[model samples]
Target: MSKKSPERTPPESLHLPRVGVETHAHLDSREFRDDLPQVLDRAAASGIAAMGQVFLGPEAYQANQALFDSHPEVFFLLGVHPTDADKFTDATLAAMDAAFASDARIKAMGEIGLDSYWKDVPPETQHRIFRAQLALARERDLRVVVHSRDAFAETLAVLDDMGFKDRPLLWHCFGGDEAIARELLSRGWLLSIPGPVTYSKNVELARAVAAVDMDRLVVETDCPYLTPEPWRGKRNEPALAVFTAARIAQLKGLSVEDAWRHMGQTAAKFFGLELPK
Candidate 1:
C-alpha cells in the first residue's frame, strides 16, 4: 500500500474565537510587496478586524498612506525607526509634519525609540531623534508606538525627562522582564506583546505577560518578522495574531475570547480609533 500524504489544511481552518486588531505590523515591507493583497485577505479570513502599519522610512510612509487609503481597515503610524536615526533630515521632518497635520488615517507616531543593538549610530543621535519625535507626538496630541531594544533604561529616562505622562505610549514588541513590566505599568504605559510570547522557551515573556494587568496590554505580529511558534521563520501576517492572543490568554488565565476583546478595546482606546461593529 502506498503511503498517503497528510491532508492540507485550508487557510480558514485556523478558527479565531474572537476578533482582534494588530496594533503594529510592517505590511509595507518589501517581503509583502508581491503578495500584499493575499496576505490581507488571509488576515481578514482569520478574523483580524483592524491593522496598524508602521512607516519606517519616507518610502514606507508613502506606501503606508496608499495602503490605508485603499483599505479602510488598515491604519498607519508615521515615524523614523531607531536604526534609521541618520535618515531624519529637515525634509523628512517636514513630510512627517504634513502627514500628522493632514492625514486622518495616520493614527500615531511610532516604531520610534532607542535601539543600542548597533554601535554604528551613536547613542546621542538616537536620543536627539527620539526626543524630537516624542515632542512631535505631544504637540500633535497623538499616541506613540515606542520600539525600545537594549536601551530601555535610557529610553524610559528620556520619556520621563520629556514629561510623557499625559501622552499615550505603547512599547511595541515588548521584550522586557517583569521588573520592566512593573515599571512601565506603574507609569501607565501600554505593553504590546508580539507572537514570541507563545514559545515555550520564552518563560520570561510569559511571566511578564502574566505580571502585567490585562487592561494595559495589546497584541501585534510585527509581521514579516517574529512569526511566532507553529509559524516561525515564515512570513508573518495579521492573521497570525490569533496565536499571540491565545498565548497571552493562556498566560493570564483568561479565555482566548476575553483576551481578544481586551486587546481590541485597549488598542481602540489608545490609538483613538473606532472599533468596527
Candidate 2:
C-alpha cells in the first residue's frame, strides 16, 4: 500500500513575523458578524500586522466604522461600488467627501471601478460613477484602489483619460494575463495579487505574477471572498492572507517571510499607514 502523505500545515500556523498587511478585506459583511474578533485574532496570529476594511458606500461606512473603533490596525476604504452606480448621486459624493475630511482612519477611496461582469448597471453609468470617484480621490489627495472585472480595456482607457498615469493607484484583485500586467506596470500603477493566484489552473494570473516587479506588487485576500487554495470552498478570513503571501513568494522565487515583510511594507506605504511598532 502506498504511504499516506503528511497533512499540510494550516495557514494560521505560518505564524510569520508581524510584518504582513492584508490590503483588502470585507470584514463588515454579515458573513463575519459572528466571531469577528476571533477572526481578527487569527489574522494577528497568522502574521498580519494590518488589514484594510473596505466599506461599499457612505452608509456602510457610517454603520460599520464603529465596529473597528478598538482595532487600530484596521484601516478603511470607502466608495460606491460600480454595481451600485445608480446610487452614486451628488449627495453620495458629498457624504464620501465629508467622511474623508472627518475620518483619519479612512485612508483611501476605492474598490471603485468598472465591472462588466454584472450588467445591472449600464456601461455609461458605471463610467460616470467611476470618473466621479476617481475625481474625489484626486481632490482628497488619497490613494485609489480600483476594482475591474471583465472590463480591463475600458478601465484602462478611463484611468488613462483621467491622467492617472504614474499616480498612486492600485489595481485590486488583479487576475490578468502577462500583457495586461505589463500595461498596468508601464502606466506606473501597482497590482494587488489576490487568492486566485493560488489556483492551479490560473496560468495567466501566475504568469502575470511572475512578470511583475515585487516592489510594484502587494497581496490581498479580498475576504470573505476569493479564498486561496486549500481553503477555496470555505469562508475566507484575514488569517488566510498568509496562504496568498506564500503563493506570491513561491511565484516570485523568494522566502515567504521576505515576501510577507516586503508586501506589508509596500501596502503600508501605499495607504500611508504606519504599522504598529
Candidate 3:
C-alpha cells in the first residue's frame, strides 16, 4: 500500500500498561514536518518510549540526524531504500560508509532489500545495489533491515549468497504467510509486525504474526503508512505502535505489558539499541 498522511490528531494518549518501543517509523517523512513536535509529544504522551526511524534520502537523513541529536530517545536505521536504488552510486556508498563509521546511533543499514513488486529500478541494478549495501553492513558488523515484497525467495537467495551468518537481519513490515515466517525463523532472522495485522481481512498475515516465536518478533508502525486499526484511515505515527503491541498481546494471549517487554527487548538486543538515559 502507498504511504499517505493521516488527517486526525493523536488520539487521546492511552495508558497501555506497557512500554511500547516502535521498531520502525518514518519520522523523516514530510507528513510530520508541520507538526513534528506535536507528533513526537503525542508519541511520548501515548506511551511510546522509544522509536527507530528509517532514513530514505539525504534530506530525510539529514533531518533525522538533527532529530537524533536533539532527541536522544529517537534512534535510526540509515540506508537508501529499494525504491531509491537508482540513486545508489560509488560516491554515495562511500559517504554512507563514512556515516556508518562515525555514527553510533545508526542502529542498522536498513529498509534495504529487493522489491520486484515495484520494479522501478532494473533488476540487475537493484541486485548490485543490494549486494553492495549488504557488504557494507557486513563490513561494519551492523544489523540489516530488509524490505522484501513479492520477492521473498529471490531476496533469500541474495541473503544466502552473502556470508550472512547469524547477524541481526530484520524483515520490516512483514507480510508473509506461516511458511515464509518459518523460513525466516529457520534463518534466525527477526520479523517486525506492522499495523495491518489489526485489519480483519488479513488472516494469513495475522496467522504469521501468531506463528512468529516471541523472541523473533518486534513491532513497527511503518508510520506515515500502515496506521493501526480504530484509526486505520488516519496517518500513522510512533504513538499508534501501542495498538500493534496490544494486538500482538491479544494474539499471543499475553498482557500488553508482556508483549511489549518481549518485543522491546528483542528489538533492543537485535539492534544493539538502548533506552534513552
State the lDDT of candidate 1 residue by residue for 1-277, as single tens digits. 9986544344355566435789998888789988898888888887777899888866677755666566778888888988889878778777888888888888889889999988778888889999988887888888888989899889899999998864688989997789989888888789999989978888888999998889999999998899876677677888888888878998899988788888998998888778765
lDDT (10s digit) by residue, model 3, range 1-277:
9987555434444465435678888887789888978888887777666789888854467656785577767887888877889988898788888888887887888888888888689888888889999998888888899989888888999999996747789998998889999988888889999999989898998888887779999999999999888689878888888888878889888988788777888887887766532
RMSD of each: 3.0, 2.3, 3.9
Each prediction's TM-score versus the true structure: 0.93, 0.96, 0.92
Candidate 1 at residue 111, lDDT?
Answer: 85
- Backbone clashes, each candidate: 0, 0, 1
lDDT of 2 by residue, 1-277 (tens): 9986545467767769888899999999999998999999988988888999999999999889889999999999998899999988899999999999999998889889999999999999999999999998888788899999999999999999999999999999999999999999998989999999999999999988998889999999999999888788788888898988999999999999999999999999999989754
Q: Single out the weakest 10-residue window by summed lDDT for candidate 2.
A: 4-13
Global lDDT of each model? 0.84, 0.91, 0.82
Q: What is the lDDT of residue 64 in candidate 2?
A: 91
Residue 125 in model 2: lDDT: 99
Which stretches of model 3 miss by more than 4 angstroms?
1-13
* Native RMSD of candidate 2 (Å): 2.3
